[model samples]
Target: MSAESSGGQTPVEYIQHHLTNLSVGEGFWSLNIDTLFFSIGLAVLFGWIAKKVGDSLDPDNPKGMQNVLEVIVEFVDSQVKDSFQGRNPLIGPLALTIFVWIILMNAMDLIPVDLLPWLASLIGIHYLKVVPTTDLSATFGMSFSIFALIMFYNFKVKGPAGFAKMFLFHPFSANNVVVKIILMPFNILMTTIEEIAKPVSMGLRLFGNMFAGELIFILIAILPFWIQWIPGGIWAIFHVVVITLQAFIFMLLTIVYLSIAHQSQDDH
Candidate 1:
């Protein structure tokens, strides 16, 4: 964005505006409209494309979109096979969804930072952040969903009694009953922290990377018009790698976590 687009606002103000969300409601109850809009839109598009590809698959001779999607599906399935244990059919599709959906959300950073916001401005929408992965709510929303799935499969595979036993008795087993009882609290504390760390770290890692990348793009947008392309072009190229790697890491971690959940403590 040029200085002209700032409309008398300072550089800091311009950055702040670019970073702000079109949000509503109060505090935790608030929703980020742009984040939701782009994320849900991309998800629907992914679903439609997958449906079309599935409906039209030809084993005799696959080409074009079929070839491309099969590559992605097969790649995701390979990852699931490597990382997921036991038999949960959902793992394959869940990993694929996480990989591609996050890639779509992260790809929003590749858009010119000012393009969508400026377009929205023409319609009186002053604030818009297009990269949904940069939004904490979106990242954490996804991470927490994975967390729920981990819990579900843990219960499914291990049963509540087994899960409770693993939770309460792991990493501190003792031959003496008294010693085992003494270590239960510490085991519980450690287990809680590990479980919380999975989702918290997952969410923060995605949000931090995308947010920093988007901020750099916004900063590039505010540079002198004649010189903006140098940095913008360079960062955009590097960011393509960053976005794809982040999506892959997120997917891999989800698989690994679920695998752990599906295993007995003895298995671990």
Candidate 2:
């Protein structure tokens, strides 16, 4: 057998190559195919599980998956009700979807980073990134979706005129004509900054955490075999908690953003 077919590449070289994303374009226009596929697949699977659990639930007798799902539903329901004062059927479901979908995506980190890609290479497909959150595009896409939802809720709850008024005079004085004139430009600048910062920060936060976790995993994979197992095992165990917490935090923030957008000025 050839050297290539003998012992094969070192684990470090194998993992480094796999971590690279399959991109289709340049800069911001670029798309990570692996991240997109894994994220969508996990989201669909979780959605199906949620539906099945709901269907299986019986008010008369509930246990196991049904009971766990009911608890999650109630928890999310209470959060939506407490934060948003409006009759929106969409809000509750949307929040639940975000929570479940994000958790499922984050859970992908629990799998061995090199497992699927290594298996794929056996069949001639070499590159695959299993953790979607590590992809900037995936996180940004989620945040952008939340941004759209915020705008929709803003218009739905406040109306065009009310939403416009918020931009003109918010978190500042527009009480007098002179004050309004002075503050209008500043208010617009601040409001614009705030709106832009929300989605960017939301996306970056998730991306940063996941990317760091992935990097650490890569670094650990590169260690000498004698020392590799120790750090790799420890980080993987700790990362299970980190990824889950990050997903939960991201979901909660989305709910909070929508809740804030839906509130009337006086409610603040």
Candidate 3:
């Protein structure tokens, strides 16, 4: 913690302050301003940079950021090509956006944990969380948005009857009409649980991993100033892998989920 934010607080207090957000209002109206600020700011910046770099394509001699971006685009496209069952023009770009945006947000955790909050405190903003993936609200927001797309594709590919078939006939079909009727409620219950589990698991997994990482950084910060660099340096090195893997896993799962949605029961 900086002199401004840390003040005379105990270690527990310091950690609490650092973990909290610059929130306002309460209940349904509540908002985490720092989470919104950083996540949206990074997204806008990413888009602007990508658009500028994209519009000035020099395929003959790509270099610097263009080379790096080309690598990332190709990597994301390859993953989509592998994971998605069929073709949807949107999947490649969506995967690229999710991967890069999440990686950018997760990268914020590498900033000396106290640095941004300290700076914010200097400007009279007391609480700030730089990492959006560490926040459940933000993670769930993205996951549920993906979940919506999953539903959309399910409808788009399978139609209303297909959805009903899955709900009523999946995992318990029968030649006899009476047996199929008997299994409808069970199939619907199981299918409902399966559907709910997807976004919940996805959101919680991202939140849990990133929150633990952030907490460790905070704990390292409260250590003796002189020796903090030892563990901090090691963990920062390892966290590069953690942040990148988290982004990739989220993006891959999104592709997989959408691909599954695109398949009809007969395809299964």
Q: List per-prediction Cα lDDT, in the order shown.
A: 0.90, 0.79, 0.90
- lDDT (10s digit) by residue, model 2, range 1-268: 1113224766556556756886678987888888888888988898788779777768899888888788888988887877766676787888888877777787787676667776777987667888888888788989998999888877777888778767778658656899987887888788878887889999999999988988777766666657768887898889888877887778788888888887986664
TM-score of 3: 0.96
What clash pairs does model 1 have?
A: none
Model 3 residue runs over 4 Å out of place are: 1-5
**True-structure lDDT of candidate 2:** 0.79
What is the Cα-based TM-score of model 1?
0.96
Instruction: Report lDDT (Cα) of residue 28, candidate 1.
Output: 89
Order the numbered candidates by TM-score, best leading: 3, 1, 2
Which clashing pairs does model 2 show?
Answer: none
Give the lDDT of residue 168 in candidate 2: 73
Task: Give each model a TM-score.
Answer: 0.96, 0.88, 0.96
- Candidate 1 lDDT tens digits, 63-173: 999998889989899999988877788888889999999999999899888889889999999999999999999999999999998888778778888889777887778
- Name the 10 consecutive residues with the lowest summed lDDT in model 1: 1-10
Counting clashing residue pairs in each candidate, in order, gives: 0, 0, 0
